[model samples]
Target: MSGKGALSGTEVATHNSRASCWIIVHGKVYDVTDFLDEHPGGSKIILKYAGKDATCEYEPIHPPNAISDNLPPEKCLGPVDMGTVKRVEIKITDQEKARLGRLQLRPPLDEILNLHDFEAIAKLVMPEKAWAYYSSAADDEITHRENHAAYHRIWFRPRILRDMTHVDWSTRILGHRSSMPVYITATALGKLGHPDGELNLTRAAAKHGVIQMIPTLASCSLDDLMDAAQPGQVQFLQLYVNKDRQVTRRIVQHAEKRGIKALFITVDAPQLGRREKDMRMKFDAEDPDEVTKSGGEVDRSQGAAKAITGFIDPGLSWKDIPWFKSITKMPLILKGVQCWEDALEAYDQNLAGVVLSNHGGRQLDFARSGIEVLVEVVEKFKEKRGITFPNPRFQLFVDGGVRRATDVLKAVALGATSVGIGRPFLYAFSAYGTEGVDKALQILHDEFEMNLRLIGAQTIADVVPSMVDATNIHSHVVAVPGDRLYDSNYESMQHARLRETTRAKM
Candidate 1:
């Protein structure tokens, strides 16, 4: 059965039981009976589609190469004669019909004037699972709400009468030129929102000359993203270290070999957090007994994040940094540093840089926002290392709660090499696919032109620490002010709904 021409449907159907199961995905056949015990989401899901095509169920959540990468070459049973195979017919539910209606009613792309606009539209149109995974943070979501709110505490101090006829928002990120001070950061499972997935960002970034950090859990294969890039397009890799050292090493070495500019190892999330909204979804439908029979002691209630994250190594530590360095020549950066001490440690360790982020407030609930951490990181760097801001040797990057070019500029003024805009781009592509991302980038470009002139700064260098008052950045208990931008875009967390009962006869 191993690559011996097209297998007939009759032959494939014979191995449907748990004793020996075979499935078709994107035209190829695979014998997954051996893999069932190791499947992260549990074997039940795959068993549901045993002896049939699982392409529809597999496409959104798993990377394109997931099956091929995990299964041995001999397990690949070659392509099947699609004509003889019975395809799975996906029924359109009432909820999907409503979502489609909302999609039809989406605001015109030009009307999406700000980054927040894309988010507002995305909330209306995205699938519940995708929205929950993207928008939900850790328990109570305090840091999630605070990430954007913290930016509001900062007040800009615009200059007067500086020649701002030609403002340049363009800057270099880790030695690569970017058209703006913001780069599209890594967010996983792109296909949940759009079919093109991470490729939407790749194509959009290429057109706008922006940098994109590819997520380790991207639905599209790493090779697919690289193959889609235009000449000289700069992209970075965001890695979640695996339990198997050899697997992690292969990923790192492969990324470097494929011209990945830098390696931004995600230092956060040794284990995926309890994002309650995501937990509420509880994607797995199989019984506990069934799941345990496959993957030992599985907690299927944790939803999509838990389902796909079993491979992450909790044993990863500082000692592993040297091993990473030994495997590749690419510049290495820690992606989830939340405090100055860790940032300084990264510098001392002779690493490239640190991203002052708290995993977009999706990990620890009360963790400080990246922008707030930037101030502390900068202050410590100057005092402890006698280092200046935007040090070429140790670049300080920031991500989380950035919704506007003003937000990007504020981070720049406070001493960030660049800010990573994650959710807005995710929302953009989710709502409008590649075109949505294009409009979002254009909106930022327009905002950069207007706000840079308004702030009286002609270039990224003109954005200085003194240009913004961050006195209240650390004060977490200040009275809330009405922010129209945030109010318009923020989707409030909902309480569980009561079951509908039959109305009494009137």
Candidate 2:
């Protein structure tokens, strides 16, 4: 038994039943026979690997320490011979394959075909509190409904009879080209949706050749996210300024070191809006019950709760942009910008781009839809001011309630250089993990192509304001006084100077 030709370990052990197996650890043989009843992942999958070398399969399914801790090591009879174990081949029939495929297919079909399809399903799949936190908006949720309702107001006047056999849906954003006009916006608590969380979303985006913006409150660390991404894949890091500027600086520096293409500073959430659903649920601002209820501890590394707890530094201002610029060469994008004046101010700052968003109607209840503001902002820049950035070019990314490719197409047709999708992909993750996300991307890409063909445009660059007829396009504009713009600029400058003073104090 000591020789190489002989079985020296527990492989030669004898099991009382052929339906079970034995494993060797620390030169001891343990019969997993009666232990099957105590298995957590169902004994059937374990039984399939019985009477054979189950070491490889067992280690991944159940860690050795897990088995050792739960089960007494004395269960091992002795150091049995190793020749008795044989590998087993589990054959899956065509019927079984079809059944599993059907099982996987039913979820996406029943849950993600349309924008509304996933609302109830998401609520069903996720914990009640977590669902409420993501779905609810500020105050009465009128803005939330407005975000969706505004999409209906901009009716598409699709054109026909133009040759569009081969369309180029790809476009450049932040000097990097993406496969689609859309990218995943920053959404937090990915692990709440699935165990893989941001990793799964990153994989899905990589597979489809789209960029995924990692949120400030991502469950996975910034380094872990960078590791999950493929080399040269584009990723944008979203930063939420907190009470501590040092912590925010660390995150921005980490993004720069890890090759994050852009830094998105979400300016909308100076203060957390009043999400009534969480309020009704008695969501503890200190220890949100969703953390424990969702099967884990809350990650406070991003200091989100601190902001929610009224610890935010109210002195944050636009003059801080240079500090951000000095830390990283990557483009800085301002998210939640709604007005044309702010858009102009963003351009004047020499910042990279502006995401015309209202935090998906979660931050402000009365703010206009991101797309609604997009048309006016672009019109102001291109038609009124006649200003444009060169090379990488300035971008107007719009988000909120974008579900279809046609919705994206309409956004681009109106004025959006690119679009950000927030809720739809989250729904996809809930319905199915990475696969569901891939399906959602595929559906959107297909719709984008079809809509492009219908509109008589072959390339994303060809989609411009002229392609869209102004006859049926209903539009609205809310004007802010010249002083408001001047005040915003003055406040931005004042904040920048304050940051300098604070640095001196430190």
Among these predictions, the greatest TM-score belongs to 1
Model 1 spans > 4 angstroms off: 1-3, 17-20, 33-44, 68-78, 283-298, 494-506
Query: Highest lDDT, which number?
Result: 1
lDDT of 1 by residue, 1-506 (tens): 22447898778878886789999998888999988866756678788889998998888887676787678899998888888887677889999999999999998997888888888899999998788888888888889888989998999999999898798999999999999998999999899889899999999999999999999989998999999999999999999898988989999899999999999999988877778787666543456676666554445545677656767899989999989889999999999999999999999899999999999888898999999999998998889878989789999999998888898999999999999988888899999999999999999999999999999999999999889999999999986576787777666666666656898999
CA lDDT for candidate 2: 0.67
The alpha-carbon deviation from the true structure for residue 39 of candidate 1, after best TM-score superposition, in angstroms, is 5.0
* Every candidate's CA RMSD: 3.1, 16.3
After superposition, candidate 2 runs with Cα above 4 Å error: 1-112, 283-312, 388-392, 469-506
Inter-residue clash pairs, candidate 1: none
Models 1 onward score TM values of 0.92, 0.67
Note the clash tally of each candidate: 0, 5
266-362: candidate 2 lDDT, tens digit per residue = 8888777766565544323333343344233433322222212243456678878888888788888899899989988988899888998888777
